[model samples]
Target: MTKLTGRLDDDRRTLVLTRQFDVPAEQLWTDFTDPDRLERWFGAWTGDPASGQVMLTMNAEAESVPAVPCRILHCDRPRRLSVTVTDSFGTWQLAIGFDEDEGSTRLTLRHEEVDLQTVPEVGPGWEWYLDRLTAAVAGEAPPTLEDFVDTYAPMGQDYAVMISGS
Candidate 1:
């Protein structure tokens, strides 16, 4: 996976991460959009996720957003999926994609349009979550973001503050 700190869609403020996955497109898509499939490897969703469905309050624990609610923007089986969210940081797109690769599929997922200035919490976050994703798909243990905010977010804040100070 190639992770770069830069703009997406030519927007200088947006950050894009392009990554490749080794699984078939269908499997990856199911794992991404299906709440049940996600719960199998990730956290337990308080409810199911379907296109146009309004997320329930219980889903706050496991959902498209951990810190806040978000809307499911697009879901195209085995190819593309995206979500739209607005936080204290800013508005942005989170997306997943898959392509045919010698019978398997090449996957690229991104957390795009993030405000690096406001949401300083997302830099090390992508690296940390992507690492968990690799482990999750491989049937291994992955740490929960909710479980690690105290551990990683503070460190992230300090690191960003340091970078900005310099």
Candidate 2:
């Protein structure tokens, strides 16, 4: 598993994780922006992104979940994407960055304004979804939710410590 980091930026809590893929940034960009491709790993979104908002239905969840409203804050094609999603849990500000080096792409996922107490569960959830993205990119079966919970649930305290820096 990849390492995760967290910080307090302007008094707002944020968590960041990076994953490297042996593929060009273009491929990863498509995987991130295309609704059909996103459905394979993350979720499928509806509505025109140009409208600055979309309804994203997360299909990878273990059980049925309601779609969330995602507001696009910024979109720099093939480079960065920033959005704020509001769901039953709360509001999540997410920043996604794509950087390419030596034909490999490094994807950075940053969640801003996170609640300190939620880091444990939130951290592993993002990692699990990213792993699903990796599997989709490689045309492999995604890891099961049971496996993720079994393996990473215990590490919640670790995430909490890493984010709290205590």
Candidate 3:
């Protein structure tokens, strides 16, 4: 696995993050694209990326995770999905690709458009969220953002520091 690293440029205020997860790409795609499967890992899911609708709530069995209205900017199955999230001043693209490794899938994610405004929370918060995602794909329930909000706040700044090539 590689330490996730990327940068923002003068032309773009986006922070592109990539991470490799030991999971199958298709399975990763399912968890990310399919609402039913997504809820198993995501605290809340609303709609289907495959269907071009937002899956903001996870399972009907789970409490509704609020949905931020987003437009599907790109939906390349088993590869990429770009969505514009509300409360977020940027368009985020989530890309899932694979490299075969020792009989497991190395799932890489690229989250684009994380500018000055988005960088703070997305960095450190991503640590917990990505951890939850890894677990979700591994068939476990993910901890809610509510469970780690306070902890992530200060730490996220530190996270950006580390990510900024320090």
Top-lDDT candidate index: 2
Q: Evaluate all candidate structures by whole-model CA lDDT and list the values in order.
A: 0.57, 0.84, 0.57
lDDT (10s digit) by residue, model 2, range 1-166: 4444433455547778788999999899899889999999988999999999999999977799888999999999889999999999999999999999988999998898888889898887887888889999999998777858776565677887776667
lDDT (Cα) of model 3: 0.57
Tens digit of per-residue lDDT, candidate 3, span 72-136: 77766666656655533444555445554654666555565455656666665565566667666
Task: Kindly give the stretch of ten consecutive residues in candidate 1 with the minimal lDDT sum.
Answer: 53-62
Estimate TM-scores for all models: 0.64, 0.91, 0.66
| Model 1 C-alpha lDDT per residue in residues 114-152, reported as the tens digit of each score | 555644566556555655666777887765656346454
Pitting candidate 1 against candidate 3, the one with the higher TM-score is 3
Number of the top TM-score candidate: 2
Ranking by TM-score: 2, 3, 1
Model 3 residue runs over 4 Å out of place are: 1-12, 43-51, 55-65, 88-103, 144-151, 160-166
Residue 96, candidate 1: alpha-carbon lDDT = 71
Superposed Cα deviation of residue 130, candidate 2 (Å): 0.8
Clashing pairs in 1: none
